[model samples]
Target: MIKPKHNYTGKPTAYLDHNILNYFLRHPETSAFEKIFEEQQVVYSDETLREIKRSKGKENDFLNKLKKLNAMHFKIFVDENHQSTNDAIISDADPFEQYARLCEQLHIIDKIYTATNNTLRKFHGDKSLPSIEELDQQQSSDFIMILEELMQKKSNTDTLTSEQLTKLNNYISRTLQHQKTIQELSTKMMLNYQRDDNASMINTYRAKVGIGPLELNNVKGPKIIEKIWSLHKDLDGYKGRNFSIEDFLGINYIPSNLNGCIPTSSKIISAYNVLNVIGYFNDSDLKLNRRFTSATSDANHVALASFADTLYSSDIGMIKKGRAIYEFLDVRTKIITINVIDNRPL
Candidate 1:
């Protein structure tokens, strides 16, 4: 295979998305990818590990391929001692941890809502609702189990006072409302620059620079306020529910450095802006596909790729967004689609 002429400071690092891993597993004898893997320093992340676990019976096969590549896996969290484990290297504290904590908090709220609603239904003589004991038996998380035990205590006493019942009902109502908001925020977080109306202008500039123009769809609206509000509310510690575009513009939440990858922070923010400029976040009817949360994963992959010299992904969405972000940010990291590498002459 002919190598590209780009100069390198060290070994050429290649970040592989989980899809590429699956592709390689399905075509183990494919010489194209084998050669690329042999020539590049491949890296992956905890997200890849999670994806591997979801591969059902093919987990070991994927692992063996990654092993052969001498792939480096980065952890989402790191030990306090900053020691590297067999699984992943230690990373400094970052926004991902904050996002994780928020998710955990949201999860607990969801569990509380489920438990309280179930209990309230039982109180109304609904036979379908599980008893507190059954909830205890089923709950796996510590917070969920604690909630179950509390409900069980209340059940055993058989003394659910009117005031207590009223409070419990109020709590359930609040949680239900917040759950809707959380779902909205999660969806907005998933929207990307898959469509941009400014393709011509972007391409015009790319042509001047001797590169291909980006294909983007135009998206616009007042609904963008809702998405911006949700992000500010959930991520930026903004207490207000209402926010203007100016407010979102004024918030400096993006970290300046992401574990030495200076361009990653700007690239992530650029991806968000790319979608925002096209009015993606403004569409209330638009929601993240529940089957897979690709936007979040894509963003995470981009961040992880900052450590590598190149990124390899079969996902067109990832490639498009990554290319746009890297180009906009002037990041040196090469964002190449898996097909491009696979199609290389051997």
Candidate 2:
């Protein structure tokens, strides 16, 4: 086994999904993201490029634009044909995920930082805002009160001369109109209307605030410590049960911003989806957690999953991507940055 190195600071090799690459190329006006994209060297494979080619319309345009913007930045790798491998591993290819899987097989993913919108509950009212239906229930009572107040204010007004009343009514109308406009604006901001279904607007806001994706905030590193410890104890293969929590935090604690490993094979791809939902990253705040394959029933062997036909499972599909960063609080009560990763898929 490879021993963990203490002073292991070095440039990270990241696998950019095609979609994420497009976001950068398409959003040139987004100067901040452009800077982030410029920081990492992009890796791809010929198969991935072909996938890009096979893609049509906007997808094609996006890839074409990226190829033009920084042609020199992309590195294409061709691993091997797993023709003789078990039928379990055989699957249709998605170049982006494939390249990422390849990276994992090669042990090149030091950390995978995926940027995503905040999927956590927002602090609002007495409790964090609930789902829209629950929010409607809570606000319904307040809505009645507001309407009643409006009626009372309207009824108490003095009857005036025709011209004066006309002016007054106009003023009231304008005020109500303005309030309507303000309400609309407020609703849009609060409920996040006019935002992409993928919550890209939330992402833009988080980026503006210098906060990373909310998903990363949920990566349970400590819980992972617990699980890893349990695995060490319960699993017969793990010999070193003496690792401390600090060591686990420092070593196994993968920041959301750090891309840990790539998913070069279909089995690894399946593992990514499985791990993502299994909540292996429960303690991580940066949503830095990713699904990975582990030893199976047989200690000597591991099993991989299929990708093409089964990639769309609702569970793994739920893993949203955006900009996630890693942070730790210092003695001064200040947040220190460790890493940053954009979750826009390649």
Candidate 3:
């Protein structure tokens, strides 16, 4: 697996989602986050800057706070030299390559199984594996077969060398940890917004448009959920046209920052395919209204955070979706909300 270069101090690196940054800026009295920022290695992506620019009044103020925090900034684009534009920040070309490469290097087999099993349980209860038709329809037949075969091989531990088995065990352990984290986050989200559908949807919709929370009643929840699902279903036929790993790596794009941490095109592409199987875009309960913005800034933020140790966001939708993607992709980054930090003891 590709391991990220780490600082010698071993402090965890964090990525602050735009909404969280906004919260910090608006509520300076929330010194809890300020303390956390001081203690952790916080980072921001070009996407965050773009989001800040949307509110001209806050752009400079946020940037100044970041400077004060000594936060690191990185470009998520495949080409480091790419101009900082909203369009560039939300483009899939670089993120596809970056994630595909990370997947290739991490040898993320166990996580793939965990993600597949979770997805299967969610969509097709009691099915241990996806049917051939389902896999074929998702364009993941070959990928699933490879994972099944690998899992079979894993069961025969006697055949593996000591080193290989150790590595396999590590991957399995990490995957289990990711699954646990997902469950915990899901539970927390459920508890926090159980009776507030409007709060949940508004937080989710914030990624698309900066809107305040609307007072949606329980009566509207089912309809909104159905509408979101319908949107997903309607887009199924367009999967082939969506950006792929080959599309990114074929261009030989690599981010300019972080000392040229790059992965092979094939591995990066494989990671991208694995995410597709896990249904990052389609299956998650988090509603992503792709129609609102041409640039999927929310997804891009999550993708960039895959490189960090933690991702902080107030948007319930991004937190849910980000956690799903990170867990499925075997990205170790923790997806959290501002509340988690606020509740932490100083």
Candidate 4:
């Protein structure tokens, strides 16, 4: 459990999400977020840059837009032992230059995306193979070629050599094992997703404790808190009689983030999705994707902004989920939703 240590001083820092920054990009003259920038030590992170890069041709255009907000880049550093993690950023990061330098220096976008995707799977304990996607494709193509050669050999025993037969048999066995592993992983992923089904979890809890669905909007309130606690205690083997918000987000096995067990960023991202699965500050409608796995950017934003004094976002979902997760993790960051700001107070 690791909490990001910031050399924060001076003004209160407010980390801005992609949406809020995009809003500023669109309405360059708008003063809606002006107050936040005026008083807060506004900061941006790689999450903001990642979303900007997704804009494709307009990536540079959006990168340039970061200058308008006067925001610094905020990145949480990993342990010194894991320096190879490659997610580190300068402590007093210049938002525009740092982001631009990153895009030029490395194809960090693709690397980070794959890393985050697998981390999300780990979060849910989803057994979707460790994303050896390139290896899978290469192996698949090789297997097909081998199968074609094997078919050709069957038509004429004269052409099939002893060495070829041995090699083909070995390849065939390896391919079959690979296919079996893939199938097993897929099955596990399917089962994990099913277990996280909001309705299903709710119904199961109800069956055992007579508690129905939870109040999605007021997830932080007593009503929703009580339901979550009862569900966990009665069905999920949570032993604590009283509700511990920290347990809701932090890795329960670890005594605390103070001991440096799990990286706080991973916990934040993982816990955000966990909150959604159980229906707190829900990101999805419960219609499809029981877990809000698609809210990967939101999760990134939450983690990046953990050490900041504040987080400013126009997204209500980010606001709610950020607030709840921050509370549970004991992060001191303040969450200011644009809608809740009231007439763009400046």
Leading candidate by TM-score: 4
Instruction: State the TM-score for model 2.
Output: 0.27
Per residue, candidate 1 scores C-alpha lDDT tens digits across 226-324 of 443444344332345464443443323322221332234434543553342233322111122322234445666776676567888877656655665
lDDT by residue for model 4 (1-346), tens = 1335654566777777777766765666667567547877677776677677666677766766666656677566643222112233435555567766777734534443443344334333344433334434544555455556544655468765676565556545654564445434434433333443333433343344443335455435434434465556644334544536455543452322223466666668767766655556556543232242347778888888877777877777777777766665567778877653433433
- Candidate 2 lowest-lDDT run of ten: 293-302
Pairs with backbone N, CA or C atoms under 3 Å apart (clashes), candidate 3: 1-105, 1-106, 2-105, 2-106, 100-268, 101-268
Question: Which regions in candidate 4 have their CA more than 4 angstroms from the true location?
Answer: 1-8, 83-94, 104-112, 115-227, 236-250, 253-260, 285-294, 340-346
TM-scores for all predictions: 0.46, 0.27, 0.40, 0.61
The models' CA-based lDDT, in order, is 0.48, 0.32, 0.46, 0.57
Score residue 190 of candidate 1 by CA lDDT: 23
What's the ranking of the predictions by TM-score, best on top?
Answer: 4, 1, 3, 2
Which candidate, 1 or 3, has the higher TM-score? 1
lDDT of 2: 0.32
Q: lDDT by residue for model 3 over 183-284, one digit each (tens)?
A: 443334333322332333223323332222221112132233233223333233223445343232222223222344343322233333233222333233
Global lDDT of model 1: 0.48
Query: For residue 238, what is the lDDT in candidate 1?
Result: 35
Ranking by lDDT: 4, 1, 3, 2
**CA deviation > 4 Å runs, candidate 2:** 1-14, 37-39, 46-55, 71-219, 222-267, 276-346
Q: Between which residue pairs do clashes occur in model 4?
A: 1-261, 1-262
Model 4: which ten-residue window has the lowest total lDDT? 79-88
